[model samples]
Target: MDSNLLRVPDGSESVTDADEEIFLVYTALNQKPTDQIGPDGFRGLGHVDSRKDIISIRFELTALSHPTSSLSKVAEDNLASKSRKGKSARRTCNHADAPQTIEIELAQDKTALRSRKGDTGSVLWRASIAFAQVILQQHQFPQSNPLFDKDLLRKSHILELGAGTGLLSIALSALAKSYTATDIAPLLPLIRKNVALNFTGWTYNTRLQEGSPGSNICVEELDWETLLSLPPARRSHYYPKPAEPNAEWDLVLIVDCIYHPSLLPALVETIETVCTAAKTWVLVIVELRQEDVVREFLERWLSKGTWQLFRVEGLLELPYVIWAGQKGVP
Candidate 1:
């Protein structure tokens, strides 16, 4: 790791100081790196069986695993407080401290789940698992992590783009007030199925039907190419509506979504459209499977002057790099 990659702009800077924003870049390692690299790396990679028709994964939140870490006493107390407050106090079980477990059922071998023309997104990707762990670490240790803002998950509206299996959204849905997982039309059912596997109450569209309680997660279609064609006035029709008419999404999650170079522009455009407001943050996590695709994605993001990029540290090891891009100053 290069020492320069750790650099980031001061968070206290005013919105007017846009010129002072700096970009921290990290080149993915050509060789495969295992979870042995650090506690933050992907842990269950060795045990994953991609050949199965349906795969299930259980992850114990990293924030509660370490007794010596900052979350030790804090998590115990939080769990106790949640117990005292009763079921009404709990937002989602994922945020609770008692070894949060999210069981995601993935459709790896389904032909109907794939994108049109038979593309990826039907299977579970390794980066999404690493991403879930990283989110927990960042939320607990915001002072140390540059990319994540602890406040964003506190009753904030979160949207996930290209949410393949909706694993990441389901894993962290408890923390947000409302979470929308969007992908192509073909893969919407797969995401909805996976969401249903873990959560009790959820919807397939923006409108929340009555009787659906205990879950704030929803699955919808958000095609990047289609988003690019729509005008700014009509674009709002495609995006998932926040609870309030004036409310904007606080965070956008993009995990392992970048792969093909042809779709890079549409993806970047979609990011820009959603993150047009100030203080909106987008976390882009990509596996270093294709160098050209990753490079082009970064280049397009950087070309957009309003977006500032920061390289997230300690969340993932080589072959995986998560970039936190904010639309404007903190």
Candidate 2:
């Protein structure tokens, strides 16, 4: 269980109405500190008890599998088949082998899942899994981590840019107070499908350790091209607008979002808009598909001289690079 979900309460007296809704639901589900015991013999925290009852049903299908460095023989064969057919090569994220044993009922039409040539947004990416793993790690050690701010993540209005497969966003919904997952318009269908698939109707309300049901997760269309094309004054309107009026993003999660150099400019601009706010934080997971492209983005990013960037060390051996940063000088 993640204590981060239980770590921050009220999170300052200036809590917005949306935050109040999340906190109220969290309190209702988890219950207050009391001197009562439950019928199951264990005491306090109804959600924890709920976990005891649910573990048997939901986790039975989940297998404790480690991340794989190589694709399975079957995926390799699929790659070879696509190559032989002269079809554009697909970008296959390691999630195909990662711990997806939780039984998400995706569409049976496997053909539809295939990624089109030159468009990686339609497919999963390794950094998405890495980002989720990082979240779990922070939840495990909320106090020690220098890379991310626990309070910002726990109670803030959060957004995930290019939330491919909605993997990170799904995991985030259970942790963050309010999470909005965004991708291109066409991918919204697939993202929503994955959301519904992982979080069934009956279990959706009960899944998160915190946050109100329904308010915990939202899916929306956010295109970097379209957003960047908008006028400077109008670009803010393109952001994933929170239902709570006047809400600004406190944390932004970007997973494997920077690969193409052409999209880098817009992506960086979008990041600046979100992070320039006084207290916002951005956690980016880049899979370094191209060193030149990655370097270009880093250089462009540094040129602004605004963000105080921190490259998350020790994750170098992993499939992706983790970056945590916040705006400088407020």
Candidate 3:
């Protein structure tokens, strides 16, 4: 891990400087070999290793379509004050059209540093912040024009695979009708705690229980290997069927989950299972760390012949890339 990667920006720095500072935090992992990366452990987050501290990171949610800029100090102070006063962040936005800031409080336990594979979910990743920013700013453009369907998230039920710290759920969940965050068993508690930390009066059930009024944001275990092994007949046994019976998930998010090569089959299979409907959209975001690994995942995805892939060219400058896929559609 590069110690300078986490350098705090000075007050005199420009928005581009600050943006580059934060961007390096997540992209730093790209310098490492893909074989050395673990499911939950990212080398870039080395500072959180073996610690149990709750850290709060603030992301200035700006429009990717425009010249990117960080929020002004005055605006940030106002939002922080409102957050401290227990006010809803939605009410704190500058106006119907202005970009808003979000502070995500998360706990990271790198105790897995001792294990063969790391549990990296306890901390926030830069890719999640970038994705959330893109989501937050999508409304600025007409619904029909963005690379990601501007209307899909607004009116849909969203499911995020390998949600990690639940940052995306915490930041954008309430905007949708429903949002479900899923990961392996070990990371569920961290996701639930982080989600609860940001959302007042929200309680999460360990598993999506039967007939219980679904919470605004739900956290459930969705191990990819488990879903892949289950016969298609038994796949619905996984918690969180689409909000409507027999309907496919409206949107599926796969951000920064493409590191380990061994998990590619399981990951692709699970995605194919959930995104069965023609309208279901899968958004896959990966840091441009290892090109070969990323190419391999894309190859497997396209080889399936069921998904039609598309890219968001607007965000080409970012260290990560976004791909949108749908099944049985041209």
- Per-candidate TM equals 0.72, 0.63, 0.71
List of clashing residue pairs for candidate 3: 40-120, 41-120
Model 1 per-residue lDDT at 189: 83
lDDT of 1 by residue, 1-330 (tens): 111222343542222222222222222242335543323454323213445556555554444343122111121111211222111212225443444443444445455433356456776776777667556544543444344444545557788998877777766776667788898887888787666544444445433353243367778788999988888788767877666578777778898887788898889888988864565677777665555566777778877877667665555665566677677543
What is residue 248's positional error in candidate 3, in angstroms? 2.7
lDDT of 2 by residue, 16-72 (tens): 232332343334334533322221233321111111101110111112432221212
Candidate 1 vs candidate 2, lDDT winner: 1
lDDT of 3: 0.60
What lDDT score goes with residue 40 in model 1?
41
Q: What is the lDDT of candidate 1?
A: 0.60
* Per-model CA lDDT versus the true structure: 0.60, 0.51, 0.60
| Top lDDT model | 3
| lDDT of model 1 at position 193 | 68
TM-score of decoy 3 = 0.71
